[model samples]
Target: MVMKTKLLLIAIILFSTSSFISNRPVTVFMIGDSTMANRSIQNKNNKERGWGMMLAGCLTDRVIVDNHAASGRSTKSFINEKRWERVLDRIQPGDYVFIQFGHNDEKEDPKLHTEPGTTFDDNLRKFVAETRSKGGIPVLFNSMVRRKFYCNENGLYTDSLIDTHGDYLLSPKRIAEEKGVVFIDMNKITHDLVKQMGPEKSKELFMWVGKRKDDTHLNIKGARIVASLAIEEVGKKIPALGKEIRRYDYVVATDGSGEFFTLEEALEMIPLKGKCTVLVRSGQYGPKPPFVNKKIKITEEKGVSWGSSAAHAEKPLKNLDLYLCVGQSNMAGRGKLSPEVMDTLRNVYLLNAEDKFEPAVNPLNRYSTIGKGLGWQQLGPAYGFAKEMATKKHPIGLIVNARGGSSIRSWVKNARQSGGYYNEAVRRTKEAMKYGTLKAIIWHQGEADCHHSEAYREKITQLMTDLRNDLGIPDLPVVVGQIAQWNWTRKPHIPEGTKPFNDMIKEIPAFLPHSACVSSEGLTPLKDETDPHFDAASQIILGRRYAKEVKKLIKK
Candidate 1:
């Protein structure tokens, strides 16, 4: 009897030990670039703290934050200097590594740079392999943007950094995929947040020293915001550590009255039922709004389909796709759509007020569609792409995550490559799929990447490859639109300048696989000179072109 009792005690002890091991604290190790590194005393004395420092405060005691990121280290230099090797030596099982680099990688100087070709990607894979070997998870973040501070005629600060970092941001993402690692695009999130803040207030987030234009590194406040984003990202992949997540929250709304809820109120209201759209109202919602919620639409409207009151007790909706769209003015969907085209796409609903609610004054109805500005709108390309998939049609959902007038660099996940626009598109794509499967990715970019013809092909290829890998679908179909003919050709601006860049775009599709390019060379109307955006007529054609390419890929 005594022996049997001792054996039972031992069994219980072993079980407890196993459980403890399984639920260990998530240790996050950050690597790469000055923006993420521990800034020098002089730098910190000036109130500059890298985003990694502020990120430490967001995690509970259970999560450990160790940042080994260095200042001005490119992919090649990081490896040659054995910085990553030092990181690899310390990594343990169940650990997480967040890598953000690329700013310095694009340097033309061979001593300090890395070509976004095989070398850049190869170094990334090495980091992934070493991390995994130690049973650690690797997360890739594209670089952040440098604040250029350009505004439109209306004084709205348009994010233009995407143009600068387009090619630089693609390398790490492609490497993340080839290495089977997770990626978070910090570049895009920060850019959108800054743009939302507008030019004036956005300056407060960076370390703007004397004559330096310190857009590359974040101050203490900026670091905290970025760290919060990283924490939210990790919570998506590993739910066990969610308790330690102090930065973000997940909520559902049951009132169905189109009323908005603060982050605090939403958290207290748990497990909300019925079909409801989590409304993010039209007012400027900043990064501090506790955006880390799950299964909520974060919308602005009260009525219409997928709105607040649309959800009833009888019908419960499951699985929602939230998209984030960011680009130049075209992505903002300027100009009007013909009534005929609007009818054909009737299933699509914009975030406008109903006739009954605002008969005399429609507050949100001023714009031609919900696609104007950044708001939660119905699935556009994702919906169309899913519709094309008749046989394997999954529960169709989309998150319209986009921003206009931004360059590709604006969206890069790495702080070094901030303001890179494509990175933002990638981040939005990942965010959109959190609720469901991403059938296809539709991209309409090239004006920014066209500037540097020498590296454009490699950059585009890497961007597509990285996007596919980040979403966990390696061979996903990617559809891109060719740059439309601009009216600059009609007027005299520069002679050989535009031709070289425009001509290089024709060769992008040739290098990529399972990718199709839509021709918008002649789609725009002759009269639309002031605005280079596609008219309603052009959008239908463009949408059709996207659909056709998607169909062709699906058949294969």
Candidate 2:
């Protein structure tokens, strides 16, 4: 069967944050007869394998395939042997159970015999209800074809395929229809496949070679094909689980030293609405590239020589400009949001708490991994700045990693340490860069560092150098905004070194390359002069000013 799926692969340095993009891992429990059991072959002469043996290879790492099927066990015997109870004991919420058991149920032996309309149907319903009771999703798959074909008068194998499972297959179908469970008709799918291959050629799928006369069990090659077929159906029936299925179509070398160089070039080869998976090899890959077709889903493959994470999106993202918004409270925005400022800006997205891009709205800094609580999250300048810069053709992505009441020393010192604000900011920015190009850095801090304003210029310069070097942008444009000019007459508690700090911020453009400073000369405070934070109106103006500086820098 032709499967339609979209997949992308990109190289990324391994980190704990890589797992944050996806939800918790889910287990897929496979329960059935020997046809689905895991077989042991001491010698290569036996050469018998089950389709379930290849299941895990068909899915992503998030899915764990636990095959519980046994040789010579039917639905009745499985429950009687407490095998079903064992499966039940391990079934957790959000797990999936694949139930397929009709092979041994067709036997006349009382130990496994079950009438299709009565005991078999009852057993199927019981499995579904009990799985749901444990909060596990239950999917029923009817028994596979037994390789029985009809022959014509000429002695050549006919195209007609016979059904050996008979009414037993109808039991799972009926139970699935009645209980509202997902059902995959493996009988019909295998029947069509076998019929198309004809009698002679189809033997390669089963164990019809020397010493192995088994027609029910599949060989290694056959197991892989069946596993792929089942996974394809799962993707179509269960979208959430299906999207996690892993497959590769291309290989990439990030260093531009291999056959395929960059991700953008690989993405350009995929046809529109077509599906492909690219395997990214190890190398140092920067973020200046844009995907030519669709937004890719990034999944991290660990333990390999080259570590990587993948990202995916349905819509096409082109020329996505990314900016790192950092510093203290002003950059995080203490402004009260108005209705207009709260509205989501068109073509602007935020690298949210989950590291996925969502529409840019108020409290853009709420997604900061190192930032404070949601109460501190409010209207930030990024909303207005993105609004001023974003267009229908060119989208924008913002990484607002700032904290309130933070000192310049804290930022500079933390730049070299792990789990600190500076490193957290860099990590988040790099994650966001996987989807877009880094445009500039916006800094509006220094309030808490007023006590050390005498050397503010020197410290801020060091901070800029560290940020640019670590981010792989040696001459990246840096835009600093002057701290709020507290009304001293009404707010006498304002820091004595506030004027000096502002002077140092204003002097950034003099010596720093590709850098500028935005003026906060007339911006309004949050509530009154006593409030050090900017008001909603002033935050909007600050955003516009920052965008103006960015536009001028981009021109050069």
Candidate 3:
């Protein structure tokens, strides 16, 4: 009996030891660039933190978060600089390593870059292999979308900017699938969330405070939300970690009423109780409707009648300033609208001063405060631009005065003072005054000037100067779209002088002040010798480039 009792005691001790070993804390190591790096003040000892810092706070004690991300490092640089090696040396069996990159890799600079075609993918594979070799689980996350969201006539979220570095996400996803590694699409997740939030309130989830107009990085609140999203994604993809997650409950609120509320109203209604989502129904709200008052999502839906309002927890309302969008044809758009897009534009109201027109007349014509225009089309620049800005939680008012085939010469101040294009643009600018304060002017009209390249530079410069003076906004930002590759002439008959004309147009932004150029050189749609209009993919690229330039201009 004594021997049997001793054996039972030993068995119990061994079982307890095994259980403890199995339940040991799971270490999570984060590796990436400034977007995921620990925020430390290089200028001063500021307490700003990165998304990785907030990640651990969202999980249970069973998970340990250790971020080793640095500023301005691509996948190749991270490895070449031995950053990944340092991370791997500390990793233990059963640990997890989360890799997020692609922001810096997209840089064309040779010194600090990774070519998305080969280097980016190769680096990702190496990270995965090294992690697995050390008995650690390699988890990959696609780069997050910068906080730039625009909507089309149908009011859907356009994927212009998101698609630019698409290979950034695709490479990781492909490797994960091939190697059986865990892949979390932070990009797609963020995109869906932004669409749900609409443009206005989504801005609150980004780094939108003083001196930094960085859409690539997240603020404290933005970091927290991103961390929470990452946690939720991990729980869904990795079953073993599901029970360990503490914040996975997302409450979505949809507005069934066909009429949409301002972003302000939606922000007021979204509760701070838990992870919440607010979907506004498809319909026009007022101009500069408070779309992004906070970190809440404002989405739109069609075909299905959603609920009116959802209440989770009451919170004080936050006020947000409005953003105005102005430009020409590309700004107007040429794509077909989807239900999702229309639903997302619920809060974006067009101040159409012109008479009622077809929703298709100009899907990009969103400036008139009282007139109707083409209401449904795939958005070009505005959809993506507005959606991205709204995601930053800033109030947005788009004052569009773009005319198809319009030239820069037409937009001069005094219609009677100048002939040709100047007179028409000045007249339209006068008509656009009733809409609101013209914050920015987006110009996409260099095609006509290509035919008259000899004097394009001087004419464009004068027009820009006159425009700023006339609007009384000498510092107003003027964003230009570089003419993409187009075949304006008939098949087998290329315009001999078009190339030089286009090349000269590309150099306009270099000479102008307060002006930035969005390159559409590589974004033209594949076509025969006839159709020159950009395709959906190319439009997205153009829009994203515009957003990037705009963000830089707006940065303090």
Candidate 4:
């Protein structure tokens, strides 16, 4: 019984030790030439960077990237200088060694140059054998492409990207196949990337900073892109290493180059309560697709920007026109959302409370952060106006932020005395601008402030001025819809200040540079013309009229 107890304790200790060893992080040792070397940010002018420098950012914390590549070092020089020896000494069980060398091997220098079939192939086999002997997995990578644009018969630079690596690219692949190790074709990968970018745009990928233009070396942007390409392959060829790679929620490219071709496909990947960012390439897309209850932020890649900045690129999508719809309850739409109006417009989008773009439907203002909740929301003018302005080619985005009974003074910039919501409106609008261009501001409030015309003109003028200044649009178009001209709860008496408020709206374009007003004349109110809100039919007409006024202002 004593011997059995001792044996059981020994077994438990061995199992715990194995578990700790397995859970430890895996190290990835990168050995290559200058193209894969870590470079110093010498000055503002120095732009040369290596692909290995950006590799760690693409991976999770479980992978430790130890890059030992140096500038102007070949397979021959690396082994001779004991750099490979240093890396080999650190190789533990279950680690990875990424080998890439060819750029400097093709050089004519005595110390750097190695014949592709003989010395180059031999050095690669040596690295693979030594890495495996240490129980470390070896993955080989061919050198990246040099951005050399070949000239056509017309003597003009064509879009074709010519390869300059020659036979040096084959040595690594041949050794990988013989040694039964995973090989990543980084040369062909970057070649395809530069080719797709074309001749002129490809210059942004190489070391073409300031007055220096070296196609053989990579800049910061180019290096990150190359690293991503390598890892994309690593995720496929090396499954264990691939599991340690970071995953993105969405990747959209108009050219069908990213993970998902369309925005809808990417959005569908989001699970409930999932925090996601959509990485989009610069291009014109169709209408913004509708998503339900998911918070998604979109980022546009202005160019081939990779690494962390690539995930948060700020350039907005082209051809998507944004219109800010702000005011009181009338603009918020109290009318019933009919079955016909309930469906989403083809090319119209609603900026939701989470600052995401979805298909514009009835109760478009339901997502307003400062406005009343869904209990007070219904059909409004935004739907009809977006429907009128949108086309198959031109997408219209609506930002509806309005309180049911908000006074004009409540919208004054930093109006602390009135507990104003001007700051919230500006914050939402600025956030919405990341998705599209801000074309116009639609206003339809003033029922609350109708009783007094005291400094009303100056207040409204200051509001527009502050909004335009804050938005950085000196001549931003403003479309004001006249307040409802009906009695409340079927009372025969109309508000005395209603006419005066409408009159002020008429004189807006006279003083404002790009402002216009739509009349509320002949528009029927809800429930036997008793309610202050316009009925569904009248709301649609009001939206159409607002669209007409907006068109005229936009033309100017």
Task: Report the alpha-carbon TM-score of model 3 versus the true structure.
Answer: 0.40
State the lDDT of candidate 1 residue by residue for 1-556, as single tens digits.
5566456434433432342266554457788888887553322245576777555445554555667778778878888887777567546566678888888888887866776766777777777778877767777888887766666899776655434687767876676555545567777777777777766687788877577667777875676566677667756644544455653223221111111224335544645564343332222111224544555555332221223323311122124222222334444443232212222122222222221111111111122122222111111233333234322223333334444444555444453655444554565455445434556667765555546666656666776687677667787777666656664444355544335655655555567777776667667741244344565456556656677877687678
Taking the tens digit of each residue's C-alpha lDDT, what string does model 3 give over 346-416? 23333344421111112445443321232212356766665555433454445554554445555455544
Model 3 ranges with Cα > 4 A deviation: 1-21, 41-48, 151-162, 248-556
Best by lDDT: 4
- Write the residue-wise lDDT of candidate 4 on 1-556 in tens digits: 5566456434433432342268765667889888887765324346677888767656754566677888889999999998887577656667778899998889899999999899989999999899977767778889888888889888899877777888988988888766666778988898889999998898988888777888888876687677877898887765566676664444564333244545766677656575676666433345557666546777654322222212222322344699989998889887655335656566776776557676565568868776655435767888889889998777877888888778887889988545457877788888878877899999988877765655777888899889999988888899888877754423245445377667887888887778998999998875444356787788899999999999998887
- TM-score, every prediction: 0.40, 0.44, 0.40, 0.43
Error of model 3, residue 437, in angstroms: 66
State the weakest 10-residue window (summed lDDT) of model 2. 4-13
lDDT of all predictions, in order shown?
Answer: 0.53, 0.73, 0.58, 0.74
In angstroms, the error of model 2 at 178 is: 0.4
* Residue 153 CA displacement from its true place in model 4, Å: 99
Segments of candidate 1 deviating more than 4 angstroms: 1-23, 41-44, 151-162, 210-212, 248-556
TM-score of 4: 0.43
Candidate 2, residues 1-556: lDDT per residue as tens digits?
1121111001111111133243656667888987787765334344566787667657765665667888899999999998898578556567789999999999999999999999999999989999988767888999999888887898776788877888998988788767667789999888888888888888998988786677788876677677778888866776767777766544444222122455666566655566556555433233535554444543323311221223223443434799999988878877754334545567787787667676665678867776754435667787678889999777888999898767777788564433388887788888888778899999988777764666787888888899899999998999999887764324356545367667777888997889999999898876566556787788889999999999999889
Evaluated against the true structure, the overall lDDT of model 1 is 0.53
| Candidate ordering by lDDT (highest first) | 4, 2, 3, 1
Off by over 4 Å in 4: 1-317, 417-420, 487-497, 528-530
The number of clashing residue pairs in each candidate reads 59, 10, 61, 0
